[model samples]
Target chain A: MSRSRIAFVTGADRGLGLGITKRLLELGWDVFAGSYLADWPELTELSQKEPERLHVIPLDVASDESVQAASRAVEATSGRVDVLINNAGIATHYPRTIHEEQVEEELLQIYNVNAVGPMRMAQSFVPLLRAGAGKRMCFVSSEAGSINRSFRDNWYGYCMSKTALNRGVQCLFDELRPEGFTFRLYHPGWVRSYMSGELNTDGDLNADDAARMAVAYFLRNRYEDQGMQEEDRLVMRDWLGREWPW
Target chain B: MDQIVLITEAHHPWGRALVREFAQKGWRVMACSPVSVEMFQDAFDTDRIHIFTMDMRSRESVQQAVERIQEQTSRVDLLVCGTLSSQGKESAGIANMSADLVLEDYQANALGPIRVIEACLPLMDHGLRRIALLSDVQGSLGLGLSGAGTGYAMSKAALHMAYTMLHGDLGRKGFTFRLFEPGPEPETEVSAEAAAAYFTGSREDEERMVMLDWRGQEVPL
Candidate 1:
C-alpha cells in the first residue's frame, strides 16, 4: 500500500465537495472523488489532470447498494482511507407551509438524501477508515441545522434534514470517538455553490474558500479534533473555527 | 359549550394523561388513537372526551380524522401533539441502525404531528389558537450526548424545527405555543403530569416560543 494519505469525498462532482477534493489533491493527498453526477465534467477533468492522484468513482449515498459498492471500489483501489467526508446533500426552494402545500413528499425526498445519505456513507466507509493512520470523519453541515441560531420561517425539509444530520453526527461521535475516531461536524457558512440545482452566486463565500476551511478542519490535530479533551464529547464548529451548539 | 382540545397518540401514557387532565378541566377532548379507543369513552365523560381512529403515518387517515372532528365541533381550541416513535432498539448506533426503523420514526415523530396540525388549523382560528408539543431532551442538539438513537433524535429535532417555524408564522397571527420536554429525568421516560401542568400554564416569554424542560429550564434549540 502507498504511504501517501488517502481521502474520500462524496458529492465531489462540483461545488464544495469538488472544491474539497481539489484542495486535498493540491495538498498532495491521493483523493477518491465519489461522483453522483457522472456527467458533471469538473471532477472528470480534475482526474484527467492528476490521474495517478485522483480516482473518480460513481457513488450515490442515498442508496445502500451504491454506497456499499463505492466503499468496496475505494478499498480495492486505495487499500485504506485516511478521511471520509460525507458532503452529499440536497435542498428545496419551496417556501410553502403545510397549509399551502403537501410537505410529506418533499420531506421524504430531502431526508433520504441529506440525512440518511451520510449514515450510509459512514457505515460503508468505516472499515477503510479503521485501516488507515488518520481516522477522521468530516460532515458538511449548515447553519440551517442550528436550531439555536435558526432564522428562516418558511422552508422546512432542508433545515429539518440538516438538524437530523447534526444529531446523527453527535450520535456517531458518542460511539466512534471512543474508538479513536475523531469527527468534524462542520457548518460551511453559506457558500455560493450548487445547492439550488445551480451555482448560486448570492452567498458571501465561494466553494473553494469553504472547502479550504473544511479541509483544514478535517485534517487538524494530525487525527483528533482540536481542543476536544474527552473522547465521548463532540462539538459542531463552523469554517471560522467557532464552536456551534449542537 | 366547552373549549375543545385535540390530542394525538392517545395510546401512549403521555397522551392518555393529557386527555384525562384536559377532560377533568371541563374542556372537550378529541383523543385520537390508531388502536381501539373504547377505554377513553368510558373513563372520561363521553360528552367531553370523544375518540377518533387516526393513524398519523397515513395522510388519508389524518384527513379523515380531521373531517370527523370538524363535523362534531365548530372549532378546536387547543392542539396538543403527543405522537412520538422512540422506543426499544431504535437507539442502535449509526452502523447498526435499520434504515426502515429510522424512517418509521421519522414518519411518526417528525412528519406525523404536522400532518394533523395542518389539517386542524382552519378550526383553530377564533378559538384559543394555542399549540402544544411534547419534545424529548435527546432532540436538543445542544443537549444530545447519548449513543445514537438516529431515528428518534433526528425525528425529534425535525419536529422541533417545525415547531419553531410554526411559531414564527402563527405567533404573529395571535397564536400561542408551548413546547415541553417532559421527563422524570432526562435519562428516563417522560413525566405526563408535569407536562400537562406546563402546557396548561401561562407563557414566560411572550415574544417568542421556547422549549422548557421538566425543571422549567430553557432548552437551547
Candidate 2:
C-alpha cells in the first residue's frame, strides 16, 4: 500500500504515452501504463526497472472488455486513480481524403479510437477518479481539431475525429466539472509520434520534451478554469499553453 | 429545364417542408425517405416532387437513390441533406451515454450526409452546385451552453467539421455550401418555407462557408 499518487495512462507502450508514464514515475507517483503493443519492449524494460511502482497493463481502448479489465486490474493494485490520462489514439495508415475512392471504414475506425476511446475510458474510470484527491482527467488532443483554426484541406477523418474528441471531452467536463473534477485537454505540439504502427518523426518537437510539458500541465494546481465564472471552464490548451477555440 | 434539388430524410417535417417549398418554387424535388413514402404522399401532391428511398446510413441505399434520381433527371441543382437521429438526446453524460448511440448519431449526422453528397456530386457538375446541411447550435462551440449530450451534440460538431473540410476542399472548386440549424429558437428562427428560400437564394460566394439558423444569421464554427 504505497501512499504515492496513482495515474492510469493509455497507449503507454511508447511515444508520448510512455514518456508521460516515465515522467510520472520519476515524480514518485505509482503509474499503471496501458500497453497496446505486446511486442514493444520499452514498457516491459521500464516495468523491470520500477517493478513495484510501474504496473504494465494490457489495454485496447477501442474495446469495452479491455477497458473493463484494465479498470479491474487498477482497482486490485490501487483502489483509486488520482490521474487518468486518455492518450490512446490512432490515425489512418495514410492521410485520409474524401476524394479517396473508399475511406468510410477507415474513418469510423479513427473515430472509434481517437474520439470514442476517451469517452469509454472516462465512463469506466469515473468511480475511481471520484475517490482520488487529484481527480485530474487529462487528454492528449490535437490542433487539427480546432475548427476555427482549421488549416488543412485533406485528412478529413483524423481532423474530424479530433474535433469529435474535443466535444466528447466537453460533454464529460459539463457533467464532472461540477463534481470538482479538473480537466486538462492538451494539444501536444508537433511532436514526433507513433501512428499506424510507425514512428513518424516529421514533426519538429521531440516526443520526450513534449511529454515533459504535458506532465507539468497535467500536474498544474492553478488554472483559469478554477475561477468563479461559470462560462469560463473546460477549454483546450496547446503545448505552449495557448487556449484553443472549440 | 426545371432545376432539381435532392433532400434526404423526407419523413420529417423539415424535410417535407423543404420538399414542398422547392416544388412550389418550380424546382424539381427529389425527396428521399428511410421508409416507404406512402404515408406522406398526400402531403406532397405536386408532380414536380419525386419520392425515393434512401438510408444515408448505408452506402448502397445512397448510391441506389442517386441512380434513381439520375434516371429521372439529368442533373441535381441543389442537394439538401438532413441526417438527424432523434434517438438518445436524453443521454445525460458520457457515463450515461451508450457507444452505440454515439455511433448511430455519427452515422446519421456526419457520414450519411457525406455519402449522399458524394453520390450526387456527379450530377451537379453543370447545375447550381449548392450543398446545404442541417446542424444544431449546440454543435457550435461558441453558441452552445449545454455541452451535455455526448451523442447528438458531439455528432453535430463532427458534422460541422465535415462541412468545414468539405467547404475547404470543394468551395475552391466552385461548390457552394450552406449549413443550417432548425431548432427551438423563437426570435431569430425562420419558417420551414423560408428555409427553402434561404437554401435556393443566391448566396453562392465560394470564398467562405457560413451556417445560418433558419433566420440567415451566421453561426460560429
Candidate 3:
C-alpha cells in the first residue's frame, strides 16, 4: 500500500527463512525472498497468492556475484530496503574426531555457507540496508559461537564457522554502530530445519516453532538498542519465554 | 543453609582469589584442580574449603569428585566451574598451534566441564540448580579479534553453543545454566597487556579497541 516496507530474507524458499518471510508478509511488509532454488513449491504458492507483495529471487549466499546481483535487483524493484535477514546457512553432521584427519570436505562446505556466506551477504547488502527505514541486519547465529559455555567437543566446522561469523558480526557492530546501524546476532535454539533434521532427537523445537520465536524476537527488537551490549548479541529465549545462557 | 558446591580449576592464580571472595560471602567451597594438595593448604585452612585433586580431562576423576561431594552432601544447589587447561600461550597463534593441540584444547577447556556437569546433574537438586561456567570474552566468536589460538577459540565457541543447547533442553527441568565470560583477568598470566601485545598491531590500537560497559567503564566480561 504505502510503497510497502521492503524486506530481503536469504534462504527464504524453505524452513525458518520461509517462515520469517511469511510472518513479514502477514505484517504487511514487501518481501524479496531469496532462495537457492527458484522452483520451490512453497515459494511458487506464496508468489501466486500475493505476487504484488512477494518476489522470489534465485540467490546463493555463497556466491559474491549472486548476492550483489540479488541486492541490486531488490534495490531496483523496491527502491529501498527495510530489513536484511542473513538466514542462509549450512551445517553437516557433527564431526566425529577433533583431529583434521577426521574432518572431511563437507566440513569446509559448511564453513563456506554458514560463515563466509553471511559475510558476503552483509558486504553486498550494506548499501541497501543504509537506504532502509530501520537499517537493521539480523544474523541468524547460534549460542554455539560462544566460548564461555561450551561443554562438549566435535561439531568442528559448524562450531568454528559460526564462531567466526559471530566475531564478524561483532566487528560489524563496532564498525556500523557509529553509523546508526543495528546488527543483531541471534542464537535460534535448535530448530528442525533441512540443515538440522526433522526433530532435534535431543529435544529442540520444530521449524515452525523456532521461526515463530525468531520472528517475535525480531519484532521486539528496538532500534534504540544498538551496539555490543551483552543483551543485544547473546539473548536466548524460547517460545515459552524462558531465558537461556548465551 | 543452602549447599553450594563451587568447583574451580586449581592451576589459575585467580582460583585462590575467587575462592577467598566466595568464602568471605559464606559459601562452602569444593575446589578441584590438578595441582598438589600442599599448594592450597593455606587457602583451604582459612576459607574452610575442601580441596580435591581432580583431573577434569579424566571422567573417572570427575565422577570420583562428584561421588565424594555426594557422600558429604545430598544435593548441590549451585555448581560454579572455572576450569580451563588452555591459556593464551597455548592458544597463542593459529599458525603455531597444531590441530591436535587445538582438539586437546577443546577437550580440556570445553568438554571437560561438560563431563563434570553431566556427572553432577544427578546430584543436583530438582529446582534452582544454577550452573555457571566460567567463560572468556576471547572465546566469543562474535568478538574474537583474530584467528589465533585456533583450538582455544574453537573450544570456547563450541562450549557457548553447547550451553545454549543445554539451556534449551534443560529449561523445563528447572535448571538455570549461565555462561559467564568474565573478560580478561587484569593480574593473571594472560594479562590484558600481554593479550593486547599478542593480538594487536600496536598498544595504542589495542587500547582503542577495548570494550566499555554501559557506564562507559571497562568492565571485565
Candidate 4:
C-alpha cells in the first residue's frame, strides 16, 4: 500500500477547514492542523483522537513571524509535508458595497487576511512541500472570484478580496508550473461554514459533504493533463458529479 | 440573431479550449495573448478565430486590440475576459516577492480587464449587451486569513469592486453584469508528476493536495 501522505491545513479549528482536517485524519494521513487560536476545543479533541497523526499548531497566515514559527514547528516534527491546504480564512460582515458610504477600515483588514494570508502560508511552507512526496498546493477559493459570472452589486469588500486571492493562485500556478508543482485555485462552492453564518449551502452539501467532495477531488489528481483550462476553472458539479456552467 | 462577442485572455492551456468552445457555439470569438500564432495553433483556427497580439499590461496594446475589433464590428454583444500569470514557488514569500510582481498582478488581473471594458464600451449596443468578469472565492473579505499574494489579491478585490460598481452604474443603461464563481476541481485525475514539476525542487513536500468542491451551491455574491 502507498505510504500515508502528510497534510497541513490552515484554519483547521472549525468550519470547512476543520471538516477537511477530520477527513484527512480518518483517511490515515498525518495532518498538521494550523489554527490562529491555539486553544480551539475542536482541535484539542482532534489531537486527542489521533495523538500521533494530528499535530495542531498556531498559525496566522497574515503574520510573517507566526507563519515562520508554524513552519519551523512543522519542520521539526514532520520533516516532510505532502499537501498544503490554504483554507484558513475569515468573512467579516455581509451586504458590502464599494461606495464611500459603505466602505470602512474593516475592508483593509479583510484584504490583509484573505489576500495576503495564503501567499504567506505558501512562502513559509513551500520548502516542506518540495520535500514531500506530492508537491501540491491547494487554495480554498470560491467561484465568487470568477469575473465571467458576476451580476450582483453589493458585496464590495468580500468580492474584491476573493478576486485578489484568485489572481494570486493563478500567479502561483504559473510560477510553480515550471518548477513541477501542481497548484490549484479552488472554489469550494458555498458551504455552511461559520463565516457564512451557517447559511451558505447549495442545497445538497453541508460541511461534511463539501469536505468529502474536496478530498475526492484531491485524490483524483488530474491537474497535470487538464491544467487550469477555462472550463475546469469555473466548473460547477453537483453532488452526483454532473457539471454545470458557471 | 443574438450577436455575441466572447473575449478571452490567451494564456495557459485553457485559452485554446475557450476559443474552440465559443467558436463552435457560433459566437464571434476574439482571443488576445502575447504568444505567437504558432504557440496556440492547436486551440485556435487562424482563419476562423479573430486573433489579437496584445499585452494586457500595456494601454497601447489594449487600445490597438480594441481598434482592430472596432474596425471589424460596430458593437460587441458579450464580453468575457480571462488572463493569468505567476511568479513560481521559489518566490513564494513576501521577502522573495517584489513590488513589480504585485504590480504585474494588478496590471494583468485587474487593470487589463477594466481597460478592455473601457475600450469595448463604445461598441456595447446599449441595454442589449452583457458583461461578466472572472473572480474567485479567495478574495472574500469576510473569509480571509493571511497575506498570500498582495498584488494579485488586491487587484482581484479591486476588480470585484469594479464589477459590482459597473453592475449598478450600468444597470440604468440596460447593461447586465454578473460575477460567476467556479468551484474547485477534483484532485484525483490531476497529475502528481506535473504538480511535482511545478514544485520544482520541492520534490519532498508531503502535503496532499486536497480541494474542497462546493456541492452545486450558489454563493452569496
lDDT of 3 by residue, A69-98 (tens): 998888788767778888888776555433
Error of model 2, residue A175, in angstroms: 1.5
lDDT of each: 0.82, 0.83, 0.64, 0.63
| Candidates ranked, most accurate by lDDT first | 2, 1, 3, 4
DockQ of 1: 0.66
| Candidate that scores best on DockQ | 1
Report the C-alpha lDDT of model 4 over A5-32, residue by residue, as the tens digit: 9999998888788889989988888898
lDDT of 2 at A148: 86
Docking class of 2: medium
Docking class of 4: incorrect
lDDT of 3 at A207: 66
* lDDT, model 4: 0.63
Residue pairs with colliding backbones in model 2 are: none
lDDT of 2 at B67: 94
Q: Rank the candidates by TM-score, best first.
A: 2, 1, 4, 3
Q: Candidate 1 at residue B11, lDDT?
A: 70
Q: B5-90, model 4: which lDDT tens digit per residue?
A: 54556555444554555566566666777776467656665445777776777667877888887776777777766556442322
For residues B114-170, what per-residue lDDT tens digits would candidate 1 score against the true structure? 888888989998878888888877788777758547778888888888888888778
Off by over 4 Å in 2: A223-232, B87-89, B185-190, B204-206
lDDT of 1: 0.82
